[model samples]
Target: MTNDPLSPQSNDSQKRLMVALALSFAATAAYTFFFAPKPQPPGAEGADAGVVLAQGADAGTAEVAVPPPGNGGTAESTLTAEAPPPPLRKVDVARQEAKYTFSSEGAGLTFAELQGRKMREQQTLTIREGFDKLFGKPVPTAPQMNLAHPVPGQPLPLSISIEGNTPLPATTRYAVEEGTTPKGAGTLSFTGRQGPWEVTKSFLWPHEGFELVYTVTVRNTSAQPQSGELRVHYSRAIDPEFEHAPSFFGGVGNLSRSACWIDDKLHKLSPGDKPPEDTRGQVSFFGIDQQYFLSALYPLDGPMAGHCVLTATPTAREVAAGFPLNVGPGQTATFRFGGYLGPKDPDLLRTVPGVALRDAAGLSTAAAFHPKLEDTVDFGIWAVICKMLLAVMKFFHGLVGNWGVAIILLTVLVKLVLLPLTYRSMVSMEQVKKLQPRLEEIKKKFADDRERQNLETMKLYQEAKVNPLGGCLPMLIQMPVWIALFTSLRNSFDIYGEPFFGPVWTDLTYKDPTYILPLALGVSMIITQKMQPQMMDAQQAKMMTWVLPVIFTFTLLQYPAGLSLYIFTNNVLSIAQQYGLRKWLARKGGNPTGDGTAAVSAAGGKRK
Candidate 1:
């Protein structure tokens, strides 16, 4: 009944108490050893909370690395995909002329949908629409061209990365900050961090034009130095629906290529062309160059030393340009770029982002960089003539407010410039018509002497005060104009989406969807050929009058409608001019000095 029943004996109680004390002491020692040290606020010594640190490269740049989580084991710097990424999204920054779409995953451009009356995609016509187009009804239009469409698995356009190092994955989720630019334009700033590296992309929409301004900053927060190629990428998944490779019978379709301006020279590569071994130089611009549209990047600091990497496949076109950089601990490197995503208009391309953009970007305007961005609209060998044609057409367009009328006026202006030469050519043909009988007689007399026949022909030509080659002067002069006009239509943005009288000629730079214009052109060409004096034999004349027209129609079926319009207008004008000249001569002195009908009557009257 005493406490001995509930409690142990004194010696036993002492032994049990000692054991209990030992166990309690052990538990206390373990808790103190494990919980005494606090985990520092990231980046301190002996911390274990799984915090990441990163080093980011630039657009088409070099390398980046992410330090390991937890301090116990110092793993090599690398990017790991084992962990789940944050939610991805898209952000749109719009202006008066365009809407730029960006992806939060890569903090790069997803696609840019341009907005402008003339910037819409080429119109597609149905039978009813075609009828309406033919009947002078209003033609319908398609949506605007959306450029920089990324391939499913490829890097987004304008994405930044290091050639060798990056902290966050290119597809890292970012925190976005939206604000207004100094010019009152909308701006989007994206920031992503991993390990000790952080990257930020700040994009500002321009008040007008297709040129956009963006700034990229890469920071290293680690206590160590970081170096890598900082690259900015521009890639496009060329939609076969929007692009067409140039065929023998096709106009210069949307032939997309990769282009770069380096060290004062421009280099372009098509899908199958071999790339150069070295792309390093003072790069001014680099991007994808479609015949009518351009998507490129020019440095806000003008031309800077960098290397360009180009990739062209049947389905994609890509360019990445960047330079090497070494960032010290707690320091940052910034890159500013001018993004051009619009028609390849020289006027627009010529004006790079200037002080306004710099000031809006929170950068100094002193010594602002100016790049020769207009060089992207290259007309190659026809540059001079093409520019002249474009200038004239633009002037006429401004005055007339219609591109079709401007083209006709341009043709008239061109014809007037060469009127003297064409008039002389017609006169030479008339004079040669007068000598045709003598030429035939000489040919008969020297049937066996080919050299003698040629001599007599030359003698007759001399007596008539006409060079035998004079009749070819008009053709010689017009050949360059024709080729230059074609090149202009293919390369110049002035006539890109301009339409003629109606839907039959929706896009002047594109082929006439209907065969009406080209076929009518063929008929007019036949009449013009017949109107010219018979300079060749019966076989050659027949071929020129009929077969030539057929071949020409087929060839032009795939050419720009604007070129055909010019030629058709020229032919009609020539006919009127020749008829007027013949009538004037008949009225002046009743002399048969006319060029077309009179010459034909006087020379080939015996055909019957």
Candidate 2:
């Protein structure tokens, strides 16, 4: 018998097998990485927050009758009970990074303007307009928590209510008192009394933080005990104009969500077609959110059992949380809650105490510092990888000082780490390509002997030191990094409204209005694919060469410019590496032909 071509003593064969096994592991990892479903746009399924409750009959059961405001009016004036509107008072609060406008109409925020942030066109990024201008008319205006009862028989439940024997008039105007907190923070007080019960709402805006503390105290001023529920209502229009708007990454409506943290996990509420139903649960935090910002209510002490109600009109959607209060004859019940109305920056959110929790039974012992708050950023299935990538990018950004430059540096760092494996993979694929002719010859020789054909094929591969899977393995190994980078850059709060490369590539978080980045990325992909050695049949290779670039180009058209920029930079680097590696192999006297013996002979020629 011919000496065994792949004897056990062959160290080269062992090394090749080890490389093959490593590459196989990478392929398996890539398969698992991509197996997750593509992320759906937030709120894509419907405008209604997912939890639907029966409102009409249920809400009526909990409704209480009270007199309208102004001079003595009876609770029985239901037919003509139009209480006079409360006088409007505006309170402006400013911190270093943002300014907020609050209206006393419902003791709710009216608008917030981020201090130095500007859109691509240099317009202010103001959250003032409740809804986008639709049709020919301007957007309708309303208070966030209007203290009005829903039309009788209406399906949506009322978010604001005074729940016991003593009910505050719907038109009661609160006496305003403004002051400073102990920490030199601005404070606003709204106090009002109805019958024997007195209510006071206080807001403390920190001197330099993203959240505010709101406290409501109810006291029994009379001889008898009193009990009532004070519902702090919140509502906003799910403006379709914001949906898929070009100003933000992932588009406007794509990131809007209404959800609550129940039992330590997030339950996303669906926006429904009908009026909102009420859901009761042990809630830690509840609210509605946009891509970069959120407006949520968090209980400071711990989780509290409360009612979460969702209401909607043709043009708007509302969500609110109800907190119960009961006071004895002389006791006061003060319910303290925290309000988060700012950017969903991971660093900032982490600073919010208890947002992350520790759990020992899981793969990771580290608990999320702010519980489910960081989930506002919406990193998809590969969250661990995404977070790590973000940390790396931030490190590079600190060094470079420019977000765009930092991203490019991050791409280079990733490529350098993978260089050694990539080199081996490319060489293995090149060797495989050279053996295609010999493989075809063996097939012809063993036309009728299938088993012999298989054995001969294995022998040929062993002798040639080739790993059949090497051609695609390196690409597979890089997929998780690619996905992670995509997710991190797309959701990065730092990149929002940040400009790069002048007007052509203004905001990294927004799509390239000129469509240049995506187009360039598609071309670069084609060039990179062409540079790689082909291991597949001619037809399949041809199809991939043309099809992949087209598919990627269209898919990336709507993605954030920062993500496209990373991909394009990576492709260019890959092309450069492949070209350099090909030359290195040639200089080493590596075989360009199928025969391994020929390469050995060439290398030995100079020595002889």
Candidate 3:
């Protein structure tokens, strides 16, 4: 009889093919949904704004008046309403590490771009122009004093009213003054004044550092005493460009943190928490931080009496801190402040001077400081492991002078350290493979009884002195290290623009632009699996051989190149070790198979 093409058997085969195709598509969609880089929801991009907290009666003494709901008004709108834009004059300062641009209008910093950075497209760190702009209004360009409470019916402190009434100009055209400091460091000064008050803003740019010492001097020119709170603002809007990038993890978008060091501890406020009403004490530092950059304000001389107010919207985060200021008539009050606007490099942050300060009476004291400023790195629960990995990588880089080579070396070292466990696992797997024939016979003998088959399988494993789970234990043990390494490579700023080989692997902190590394990694994994001794049932082994490689390849496609490089190197090392171990065992004539005769002979030899 001739089989017909349209027979039920043919139809069944076609249906099976369609189902398989549908499953493949579903799996692809599932992978994309779980592992693909997802665009953040509106207002959710920069959520982990660093620790924001406040203490002290002065913290929330003056409440910012917000217009009632349905007014279509925001704090920015309410504050800037009817305010004229100040005529802005540009000021540029260039150093070896960074370039700074300032506008005379509010003496607000317009931009700070780091030099020698690989990804320079959006490297400018300053998100906004002025400190007062944090509050949604145009305050004087220079940092100035704000009244604790404005007089009833009077304009808010540091508002347009202050600029309109006081002889102090809302916008002063600061004369550019240059001088060489005693240390031969270059100094840039912008000096200006409003009615009866002379304000001079000076910056001491070192020949070799990212930290800039900024000093603001306010002189009471009038015959009466002037008392108010001095305020410095650090505000940044989330970078829209990095919102979709893989490096934009943790605190991307509206996830920013505003934190202050109070009473020797770091106080962080959540997004929904109200800004502390009164934060009073030795405030060592307060700033706004994003994923890769930090903009912080520090008191140069000592812990100043200060409090911070942190506010955020869907697109921006603003931190405003106030320091007590009292300038006697005809007396000048010069306050020194330090500003850090750069990458969140732990080493760089450590190099920042004035982390410790001297108090009055010449006693040295620890300031309100977070230890190491390392909190900015956000290494998560495995932070300790991550730091260790980074240290090792850095050490390797120092020796090899190439990040890609260093990563390979790091992988080798990790593998060597875990060699014993992996060796044992390989032996166990080989034993399981040797027992596969016997296991298949037992399965067939008890084909109708799954419980009896499992019992007999366990008894067989016991008799052979082989652990069925030994192979899995080593992998489980190494899981944390693998996870830590992945996190470290992904979040490391040092690797952001670091090149592995040449232009092709230009940025290890980002995904491979050419997809070569991930594909190679996937291929290496397949080879490693094939080389390893397998003990799975035929169907299980077949499924793993095909599915695992594809799944890993797609999953790793979105990971940073550095991570992919590590995995690829590790797989290669594992394959080499497995091959070497197998050859060594064969030469030794040890039974790699758990056959009953080999087991009996080994036991008898041991007894002899």
Candidate 4:
């Protein structure tokens, strides 16, 4: 309404409103896209993985069965002569819900499928125990988990389920598959009976960073050609709330809008394209306390036809498993699918028949290559330069056996390489500070006119040969380097458990719970900020002198300890460099007063 077209207060208010609207829209879109309604499948129905009790409930009753020697029996027998102890048993009861339990065949072997739960698909009849055969040799261990949430002091539940609508059989043991073929040793013993059709299966830990693979060969024992629907059902120990979370399956999976190595030259399937009639087999994914998405390549004509169904919600029941396949009389159709129940590992991903896994932690493969094309002006050239730096870091790490030290050495190397630019920046800053008195006089003469203040400042900058942004250039150059280092630390599995100088710091990719590094980082930052050139305003000074160090300290508390240590060391070194620069500046006729005089005002000749 007034003659003023650009009042400060009105402009600021308008900016705030625009920002709020933009944020609200972004949040709404994110919710609609990422958290939209996608119900769970029916096959996902189940209670928690129930607990299994030790042998017997009573004391001294002994939970396992002890067998006596068959022919040669005596107390003088060697201890090794005694067979390994039987596998531990776990069972739990769910109120008003179906019951499930799992047990193993023997020590270091997978649990067998006891009564209940059998799939209709033909599979090798190995005991449904938890185990893996590496190099064709049985691994005497259990499946390794990235993180364990076993309820302390409470029994762990064993999950059990059946698929393929296989009819329950009366009490009988069937040898559908054998591990050591021709009857050498290992075998799967499927004991079947009726009544809710429960089957107990055991599991063994997998090798570190690898997933446990359970493959069983089943003979279509039914005389009738049974074919209709196939079910793949499971129950886990996770809660219903986390059952549909992508993280429950494997966080940071390789999901892409395009493929890198696939045969994409030919007319490929679009996101909405459906294949030929013969190629449209159904894939139903169901899980309890587990979230999953599926992509499959079926033998179409010769090569393969791809079909996929992504799990959208935690409550969507029973995604249709397409139509059923016909099982010929006495003939078996081998169905191949796998479950990845661990963190995303590049090497282990090869075992899965699909795309690589990526984390939803914001960094995408395309984003990693963004600066090369999108930010051509600022980062395009720098990306190429950083590649050489990355090679150097890798080379140093290869020699030192520690990434933390390598980062420090790399930082030092960069500082050395850019010493000339930094020295110039420091010299310019010192000169600018020395001329603060003169600059303030100019500001006071033109205080009422904003345009004149900027012109006078520019004129002074020209005379002094000081580009006000010179200092910013060095900082700008360091950003790409810092980003590259961050990426390296984030993705390097070698640093997962690698020790740096001892237990004081282990696993450079995770936070140091003790807060030692974060505090040290805060202190170092404070020191460096104090030594740097004083800001042009009290607000700016307060931010650099107090607010930033406190914020970074609190921030570092939650970041990886390795990253904190790197930042802390960097700040300490910066403080030392700044101290040296200050001493030199003082000797070179620079102003002794640290309260940047250029920030003063002409009102009563006051210094601000």
The prediction achieving the highest TM-score against the true structure is 1
Candidate 1 lDDT, tens digit per residue, 51-161? 343333322222234443343333443332222333577787767777777888888888788887777666555557767778888765677887868877877888877
Cα-based TM-score, every candidate: 0.81, 0.69, 0.67, 0.50
Which residue window of length 10 is worst by lDDT in model 2?
A: 354-363
**Where is model 2 more than 4 Å wrong at Cα?**
1-86, 118-160, 164-172, 221-224, 245-253, 270-279, 310-317, 329-331, 353-372, 440-465, 591-608
Query: Where does candidate 3 have its weakest 10-residue lDDT segment?
Result: 141-150
Q: Any runs in candidate 4 off by more than 4 Å, and if so which?
A: 1-178, 181-324, 337-394, 480-491, 581-608
Error of 4 at 605 (Å): 21
- How do the residues 1-608 of candidate 3 rate in per-residue lDDT, one tens digit apiece? 32787898888888999999999999999999898887666535232422223345434432222233345544344421111223446778777767677656545565666676442432212223222233354432211111011223322212111121234443444556778666566677776654456678777766666566667787765555667766665555544443332322321222456667765776655445574434667788777665555666677666777776666544445556677667776788887766666677787777565322222112234542323455667778999999898899999999988888888998888888888888778777877777777788889999999999999888778777888788777668667877897777656777666878753565576566456788998888888878877787878777677788888788777667788898888888888898999898777664544453477445334433
Instruction: After superposing candidate 3 on the true structure, give the runs of residues whose Cα lies further than 4 Å from its correct spot.
Output: 1-88, 117-176, 191-198, 219-228, 245-282, 290-292, 312-314, 326-333, 354-371, 441-455, 590-608
Global lDDT scores for all candidate models: 0.75, 0.63, 0.63, 0.41
lDDT of 2 by residue, 1-608 (tens): 33566775576677899999999999998877987566567535443323322255323222222333343433343212122333568778766756666656545555555544431112112123211221122433222322112223221211234666776543345567898755567788877655555667887766666566677777765555667776766555544544433332233234355566766566555445455667777778877665666667777666787776765554454666776767786578887676676667778776664221111111133432244577778887989998888788789878877778878888898889989888878778777677667767777899999999989887767655577777677679778987787667667677666766753454676666566788999999999888887866688788778898998898777676788888899899999999999998888766534455464334334223
Candidate 1 vs 4: which has more TM-score = 1
Report the Cα lDDT for residue 385, model 1: 89
Report the poorest 10 consecutive residues by lDDT, candidate 1. Answer: 54-63
TM-score of 3: 0.67
Instruction: State each model's C-alpha RMSD to the native.
Output: 8.7, 32.4, 28.6, 30.2
